[model samples]
Target chain A: MIEAKNVNFYYGNFHALKNISMQMEANTVTAFIGPSGCGKSTFLRILNRMNDLIDDTHLAGECLIDGQNIYDKSVQVDELRKKVGMVFQKPNPFPKSIFENVAYGLRVNSMGDKSFIAGRVEESLRGAALWEEVKDKLKKSAFELSGGQQQRLCIARALAISPSILLMDEPASALDPISTSKIEELMYALKQKYTIVIVTHNMQQAARVSDKTGFFMLGELVEYCDTKKMFLNPDKAQTQNYITGKFG
Target chain B: MKHTERELQSLKEEVSQMWKLVLSQLEKAKQSYFSGDIELAREIASREKRVDAFELKIDSDCENYIALFSPVAVDLRLVLSLMKISSTLERIGDFSEGIARHVIEEDCNRMPPQMLEDLQLDRMFDMLTGMLSDSFVALESENTKLAGRILAKDKEIDAMYCNSIALIDRFLSENPSFIHCGLKTLLLIRKLERIGDHCGNIVEEIVFYVDAKVLKHGAKQNKE
Candidate 1:
């Protein structure tokens, strides 16, 4: 389980998130939904310490994964990133073969011999539902694949390291409906072994894929509940108005 | 997907219009049944076509709304409840029209004041009218406070129905010569009872739209 307690995040002088507290369970999909600039992406970054790469950022309160604070100095940043992988909004595959893209993380870590790396590559590709499409053309450049397939390759790259927690920031927003649906379906399949958290602008996508949904506004966590209740009858009027498109 | 707010508001108005038509249908049918007015009965029958038309229009509109906008949360609940509410209202319209037709065909003008009072048929119509009216008011205001009270009235109608069945059976044995009118009276009573049930169904749909609670098939409003 992942938990954030009274978290207040700041970028330079700007307070991006205020006193946000939430819990996300293992092997389930949790979605964060709000308008742009709502600090959802910033919070997702905090889980893997990706914010550490940004300059002049400050954090108050504890972010815990399995009862240990990830921000603790004793924890290595590179190690934490390997355990908590992320897939960004755009499908960014390097100028290399699809096989090498999945093997990149393992190769950087020098995880095993060439044969072991190849097995892990195939396993991660199958886990992301991309193995069949790319198996025959494993040596072909990743740019040869379509936009949706490229996104899946990025996901396979993330899963290659066997991360327990996966953070996705609008992973399907740039893709078409068919491609978006493929990504959504892939999220459902991956949640069987990985705890997934996604930031999305699409309310229906959140409703369709998530087990729990959190509604944010103005950097504040407005309401968090079971997905059905959040979509069907949210307790707060602000959440209702936002979801119903009555927000002023 | 665009202009969702205006489309939702327009859908609400359309459902309200259909609601008013169904209410007027029930009221006219009740008046014709009690007064044994054949002309008014014919009018009620003719207006049944309009209720049918409203049902068809509302169903298609909801489908189109879903196709175009893909509503969620309360917007989804409103469309879903409107679909069921319109269907229930249409069924109530049918029962009311059935009562009107029975009046036009039978000689209920001589249905004996004592027998009518014993069956509480007048009180049944009064409660059914109140139930339908209250459901519309609740829907208009988007409040479920009226739902509990409206649901309670259905129980009263059910009690009257149970009492009337025994009274009608006793009357049939005593007045063998008036058997035809007695059987027709029983049929009208049954129709009124069904109207009460359908109105309660509308109340349930109202509660679902306003509070997102499903109170069907013996489910109580949790209110939690």
Candidate 2:
């Protein structure tokens, strides 16, 4: 449901992304893979104007979500963010009670009905696959949970608002293998309800989770194709070399 | 420094040399079987160690590359397929040595006249040689079409194998005294049939390289 057309982005004349264009289909996981500093995260943040927070950053492109350019002055940034939720590389949960952590989004958006908010908190936690573990301890602080639990709690917090799109930047990188796999499984499950765009350095994870894979190198989209073909037999040598661990 | 290029070149050379050695052993065995030379058969049997050593070396090299480089794409496929194809080649070598051992024990001169003059057995050997040679070429060139063609030839070899079985049965009924020689000849045909299988495996590897598809079991059926 997101489309970027001939997108050129710059950090004060140091062209970070060059004429990058891609269409993200609704309710499918699309993974962006490349070496570090290839502008994958930059392109991801621009979807919801997260880049607008950075000074001296200029963008020239049409980033459309559901046929309307989000960069248009008429579009509201707050509304765009509410529609497009994000989770960071590390789990950044507010230091609050587990109940309040899920309630924070509804609270800020003035969704302030005591019993209604409680229902949403549980539902969001359930949606994020964190409800069973933390249901009895809703009043316990978020810090009491393990890294994986905390990350899932953070996901619950993001899902509290009922966003249609979820943008994840290396969501499982800081977690252990079991946690990583859980997150991968959660992503696969989440795709039926939300469109996901994940940027990963792990090629195998990208192959495992995504329906389509975009191989990026030095801020260029070298190849984009079905995940199986991309991993088994990529069309470009650069894509092949990068995925095979032959080169960075 | 990335030594992938160097490692790939080294692997290519090693596999090529191993192919040459195996082919020479097969040729020696065939010549010994034809020329009634028991010493040549014994020599082929003794040289089996070299084939075993080559297989071990290639296996270790592939494992080292995988552990160190974590190769992807075509490189990954090549290494993986090479590991499998190497073992198949080694097995084919063992079969060749088995045939040589049988010839040595049976005393080549005592082999029956009808079994020795059987033209179908000669045709099967010639087809086996052709399949091996074509597979080697297909692997070197990464020619998927040629590989498929070579794979199709395997059925012809199978038909020859069936023909040889019928010939053996006919000879056994006509002369019961030649049972030992008949069984040995039948076993030799079985060895050749196994060689055709190995050649089919090599063709499969070539197809994997060219098309990135694993077509080993029921490959022909699937194509149909």
**Superposed model 2: Cα runs more than 4 Å off:** A132-146, B1-18, B46-71, B107-130, B140-183, B214-224
Error of 1 at A18 (Å): 0.9
Task: Quote model 1's TM-score.
Answer: 0.96
For model 2 the local lDDT of residue B7 reads 90
Native contacts retained by model 1, as a fraction?
Answer: 0.96
CA-based DockQ, model 1: 0.73
Q: Which residue pairs come into collision in candidate 1?
A: none
Q: Write the per-residue lDDT of candidate 2 for residues A1-248, one digit (tens) a residue.
A: 99999888999988998888889999999999999988899988998899999999999979999999999999999999889999899998898999999999899999869999999999999888989999899998899999999899988998999899999999999999999998999999999999999998887789899999887777778888888889789988888878866678
**Which CAPRI quality tier does the interface of model 2 achieve?**
medium
Candidate 1: CAPRI quality band:
medium
Highest-scoring model, TM-score: 1
Candidate 2 TM-score, C-alpha based: 0.84
Question: Model 1: per-residue lDDT, tens digit, A115-203?
Answer: 99999999999998899988999999999999999999999999998899999999999999999999999999999999999999998
For the second chain, the TM-scores of the candidates in order are 0.94, 0.93
